[model samples]
Structure formats: C-alpha cells, structure tokens
Target: MYLTATLDEMTEAQLLDHADEVSRTQRKCEAQVLRIAAQTAVLNSPETIDPDVARLPGRERVVRFGGVGTPDVAEFAAAALGARLEISSGSARSLMADALDLMIRLPQLWRRVEALEVKASYARFVARRTRNLTPDQASYVDERVAEPADGRIPWSRFEDLVAGLVVASDPEAAAEAEQASAQQQVARPTRSTEDGMRGFFIRAPVPVVALLDGRVQWIADVLRSLGDTDGVEERRVKAVAVLADPHRAVALIEEFAQWRDGSGERPDVDWSSVMPAITLHVHTYAGPEPTDTVRVEGHGPVTGEWVRRHLGPHARFTIRPVLDIAGQAPVDAYEIPERHRQAVHLMTPADTFPWGVSTTRHHQIDHTVPYRRDGTTGQSRVGNYGPMSAFHHRLKTHGKWQVHQPVPGIYFWRDPYGATYVVDHSGTRRLPAPEPPSPAERAVARALFGLAA
Candidate 1:
C-alpha cells in the first residue's frame, strides 16, 4: 500500500510535515555519520596499533602516531575509513578533516550538533567559513553563532553574520588578505573545445568583472531591442560578435580612455540606466584617524587604499544617508524610486535563483508578490523585491509559479505542479515533491511483492 500510493494523494500540509520530518532525520543521520568518521580517524591512528609492530622508531612514534603531522597517517586513515564506508579515499579524507576540525577547533559547534540542537550541515557551514580564521577568531565566532537560541537561521544570514564577525575581529588582517588575494587575478587564454565552442575564463577583481558583465549585457540588450528575439545563448553570442568587431572595439577603447582622461566627448551610454551601478562605501571613523577598510557593494570589504588607486581621479562620489524607516509610513508609487531600487540591488545583487547568473548584467526587478495580487509598491522594501533573470521573471509572471519571501533575501518558490523550493545565497533546496513512482520501480514492485502499479 505504501509503494502503490502516490505522494500527490496527500494534502499540501501533509507533504510539508513529511518534508520536515525527512529534513530532521537527515540532519540527525549526518551528525551520527560525522561522529563515526571522527571515531574512525582516531581508531585508525598508529597509536591504536602496536608501534613496534608498525616498525616506527621510538622517538618518531609521538610525531607519526599522536599528531596528524605525517601524510602516511592521513593516507592510512583515509584508506581505512574509505574501505569501511565504501566511499572514495578523497571523500573520506574530506570527512576526516571536517570531523577533526569540529572536534578540535569548534568544540562548541560540535557539541550543539551532538546534542541535536543544531543541524550538522550548519556546523559544517560554520567550520568551512571560519577555516581561514585564527584559532582565537574561530572560537569567537563559534561562541557567538554556533547555535542560535531561537533555533536554525537561514544559511545566507549565517554567512553574513560570520563575515561581519570575522572582519570586526581583525579588520587589518582582512584588508591585507584581500590585497594579497587581488594579486592572483588573471584572465586565462581562450580555449577551444572539441565541439568547436570557445570558452573565456577570467579571475579578476569583483568590480572589473562587474564592469565587463555589464558591458556584455548592455550589448545583448541592444541587440534584443533591435528585434533580435533569439534565445539567451544566441543573443550572448551575437553580443560577443558585436564587441569583437574592430570598429566597435576601437571606438569603445578610445571613448573609455577619453572619458578616463576627462578631455574627450562622453559617450551617450547611460550606465546606471543600462546596468546596475557599482557602489563603493567608505565608512567614516569616529576618530580622526584614516582606516584601510572600505565596503564594496556585492563584494564585501576591501582596502580604502585599493579603492583610491583603482578610481584615481575618475571617481564620482555619492553620499546617501541610511534611512530610518522605523516610524515612517510606506510611500505608494507606481514606479519604484531610484533610491529604493538601489537598496534592493545592494541586498540581492545576484540572481536569486541557484543558477550563477549575474543580476548586475541582465536582470528584472520583480515584485515577489504580484502588484495586482495586493503587493504594495510602497518604499520598495528588500523583502518585497527580488532581482530575477529575464527568463525566470517571465516564468514567475506568466508560468503559474508562485514565490514568497518569509525573510529578507530568502525566497520560497512553489511551482505550477506544486513542488516547493527554498532559495538563498548558498543555493536552492528543494522541498519534498509529490512525485509518482517511475514505471520501472512500479513494475519491479508489482513483480516481487504483487503490489498494485
């Protein structure tokens, strides 16, 4: 009867309840697995075996067996755990690292998971995010954010909170790290595939990527406006073709250099209108001393020195005070105000979907709830607005999909067929779907147990 019945037969509420149960059970199992993996690592240590039988020298025993100082011990542990768990050595090694980190550096987080007070995945999330932090800094984060008394928080909020704590712990260290990392930026040579497709890859500063993304999107939008109703891939191909043209390439270079030099005629391109504007925020220190840290919208914190060097004399500064909307009423308007739009863009600078599409380049500012469906366009709050790719926007508008924001920057989407999803900065998590059994499964069940198909 269980195998024969379909999930669609259950009500929405029932489905949700079952999904919650599944999620809880999965978290518990993950915690147990991590515990077992940690135990396995300990048991596989050379100390667990006879040192004399293992042929270790008397003085070398402590270093080789006691500590994770030797690669051979790690390899032995990985091999042992992999064989026991029927997994790859690489996977076992990763598990061992996470388990050891939890046991050693993040005892509080590990305790929370062991007690089932926090999800194992969230514990791992904190561990991974704080891996680069000093032990003292990691402990500080673990103490404050390992287990919220109110229960689980969204991964996106957790990340932001951790990042804030990390920067606050040592701003100078963060700035130095950022500057050092910036030196590694490079654009690799283009590669051609066997299928005759070419790929270009770049590892650069966020601001540089933002500019290039905006330019490509602008070209694509222009081509689309000129009655080029091609698909997304085709339109992007055409946009690159336009950019690669000798005339347009030379013209763009000359115009940009002129603009930079402040002596040539400015191009008619309305940058803010065409693309999401890049915002650099410098926080004024209370004391008269200058600080190195500056916050770049969508890119987190950077050194003030880096910002100054990049912008040089071509920088235009905008001073906008943070609005206190506490006692103020929401203003109703047919169009979202520029300030409000910019606020929404800062909150969700990328496409809300799990797909790694850029909102700065090509996106639509959409109301989470339809305006016709009692969505108030007042003040353009972040909770009510989301940036979606054009394709996703159309799906939400006319494809019978429903979306709601239970919290700012977190979206829950229900498809036309009733499958639900939760999306955040980390990625998308699908809720339980009321799917029918596949024909093969049904057939096998029928043949084996005489169950109804």
Candidate 2:
C-alpha cells in the first residue's frame, strides 16, 4: 500500500526504478528462504547424530543424498518443511538439496544469491542442474552462470552456455546424462483444455518434431488462403488438431499444395461438409440486438464474424433446438438420454472436479445423486449430473469425496480433508476453511479416535 499509493504520482522512469528495486527486495527474501533450507539440512544432517545412534535397530537413521557431497538429512526433515511451505515433501527435499548444493559446491553463486546480485530461483535452478558435477565442475558453472555481464539472467543465452559447460567440464558424466535423457520420451495431453482449447505434448528426436511443426504451419497457411480468418497461430493449432484424423490432415495438406501451385484464390469449398460432425448450439435471441456468439461443442463459442470468415458467408447453418440447460425434465430411465447428456456437456464442458485439468469429451457423466434401482421417476436428467473423468468419478464414489449439484451447472464437492470446493461457469474455487473445532469438540474427537490427548 505504501509504494502503490505513490505509483500514480511517479513518472514512467521512476516507476521502472521502483519495479527493479522491488524485484531485488523479492530476490533478497527468496535468498533468505533458501538459506533457511540449507540451515535446516545442516541441523538434520547425519553428522549431528551420535555415531552410536546412526543405526537405530535395523536400518540407518539419516537419509543419504548422493552426488557433489551435498548434506543428507533425517527422512522427516523435508516433511516438516513441506508442512510449513504448503508443498509436497518431495518438493521440499529437492529445495533443500538445491540449497545445500549451492552452499557447499557453488559458494560463488551462493554469495551472489545472498547479496541479491542474482535471483534465488535462477541460483537454485543452476544448483539443481550442477548437482551431479564435482565441486570443481560446479564451481566452473558458478563463475560463468552466476556472474553474467549485464547482471541479468536471460534463459536464451544461458541454456546453451550451461549445456556446453556441463559437457566440457565432465564429458563422461555428460554423455551418461544425454544417454539417460534419450530414454525419457513422452506423449500426453496437457492441462490447457479449458474453454475448448486443447493441447497434446509429444517428445521425440528434434528433427521429427520439427517436421511435424513445419507441416502444421503449412496447413495453417493453406487455411488462411482458404479464408479462415483466425490468427495464424490459431490456424496452426487447428491444423495440428486435425491431424488426429489422418484422412482430414492428408486432404487439407493436398489442398494446401494445390493452392500453393494455383492462382492463390480462396477456394469455393463447403468447409463444414469436409469437417467432422460438430454440434453447434446457435441459440437465437428474440431481442432487437441478437448476440453474435454461437456456442459450438468441442470448440466453445465463436462470433458471427468468425463463423462467416471460417465457414464462409454463404455457408448453410442447421439451427438445432437450444437445449435448456437449467430445466430439462428428468427422465425415469437410469441410463442417460443422449440429448440430456449433450445438454449437460454444453453446460459444464470440462470435468467437474477440483483441479481436474484435462479429460476428453467422452468422459463419464456421473449422477450427482446416485441412481437407485428402486427410485421412481427421473433418475437421470440434465440437472442431476455433469462430466467427470473416469478416475474422478470412481474417487467420488469410493475415495471419501462427496459431490452434489444444488442447481444445474454448479457442483459443490467435499473431500476427506474437510475442504470444500465448488465448480461452476467461472470454474473451480476452494472455499475458505470452516472455523476450528472448540475444546469440547476436540475432546470428543480425541475420545472417538482413541487419541492420547
């Protein structure tokens, strides 16, 4: 509040200086946190324990972390840190490892961190990367990486520099690392599937991935020439998405090649005829000024301008009955009706669970209230359910998580941890925790759980 109050009075140059100074302050705070982590590791180190107590009865007491002679800690040390940091124990352990590595192996970088000459995050990133190196090798990186010419850490310049140094410092270790990295290929969906956007990550040899990207861009250019008025980047995304259907990708690529060789005019093709069957919820308004946006399943909503540009001005439209999301009559059948299911999907497009990032369209639509065999009247309806990934659905059913929809298009969930989360049009939000239990309640809880309170 103090600085922000004066921001409006400050000139642009003054604002810039203020931002830089605040950034340095933030960096200093980060350094303090890392210093604490390093100190905590020392306190938990095996050397702190008596030699006789090193072995309790069956196993060694202290956790041993290898490489660069970074200090080891008691197994529960990270857990204690994690509780305070609101992070996982594994993450806390990595933080401790990175801090100790910087303190012991890269003392030059640690000094830079403490002085606020470099960001703590940047220092820790280097520490993690250089952890496998010997003290001399780590110091070699510390001098170059920590002491940048411009007092700034730009990833573009350092990425290659760090890689070259790592290889040059210890060739055999670098080779082993590269060999290990080659085995770590993966292909998976990403968490960016909100509001009909999608992504799939594929890691392979550089050349193969490069070619795929090149081809997708080529298709996007073709789409532009064909009067698809979306931005080039957006067109590229659509082009890549079409690759899921090999036949369509091939057709589009061939058309692109033909368009490249021809007069370069917008093709007079019916685009929708070539595209997959899309459920477009083009709900028309009775008001004088009707809305332009049409809600299309799988792709969310698009404006009339977009529709005209992509689908062509003369393109025909099929005006399906607008599914009333709020008040669909409940059907007696236990199995969901296709139209009802479609309406539910339109209402809440993504999986209706806290932090359920990516689930395909075909994900299970779980009944909010369980459908009983003996239950008379509408068991399966629009308001009764929403989309859930198979895993989430099972978890809700069996893993002590409960969900209920008090209204259509909104879901409230309670987990085993006594936290409440709600999912609706604006997306998921964790409600604030309830008031703590009273002493009387605590006494009862202790008695019920047989706790030594």
Pick out the ten consecutive residues of candidate 2 with the lowest summed lDDT. Answer: 149-158
Runs off by more than 4 Å, candidate 1: 1-12, 44-46, 49-75, 115-117, 147-173, 190-192, 224-233, 245-295, 301-314, 327-329, 339-453
TM-score of each: 0.62, 0.48
Q: Which ten residues in a row have the lowest lDDT in candidate 1?
A: 62-71
Model 1: colliding residue pairs: none
Model 2 lDDT per residue over 135-164, tens place: 888887777666651133244434444655
TM-score of 1: 0.62
Q: How displaced is residue 127 in candidate 1, in Å? A: 1.9
- 1-453: candidate 1 lDDT, tens digit per residue: 223446898767666667767767777898888888777766666555566655655332322221132222434667667778899977777677677777777789888888867777777766666666777877777787764511334455456556755665567787677678878988875766767776788898666786777667766666566567988778777767777796875455445545555775755655455344654454433356344555565565555666666654545777666544332334465456666566666566667754424646236878786555255446345577788888888888888888889877789888765778777655556675667889998999999999997
Which residue runs of candidate 2 sit more than 4 Å off their true CA positions? Answer: 1-21, 50-54, 57-60, 79-92, 149-151, 184-198, 237-453
Superposed Cα deviation of residue 232, candidate 1 (Å): 5.0
Residue 93, candidate 1: C-alpha displacement in angstroms: 2.5
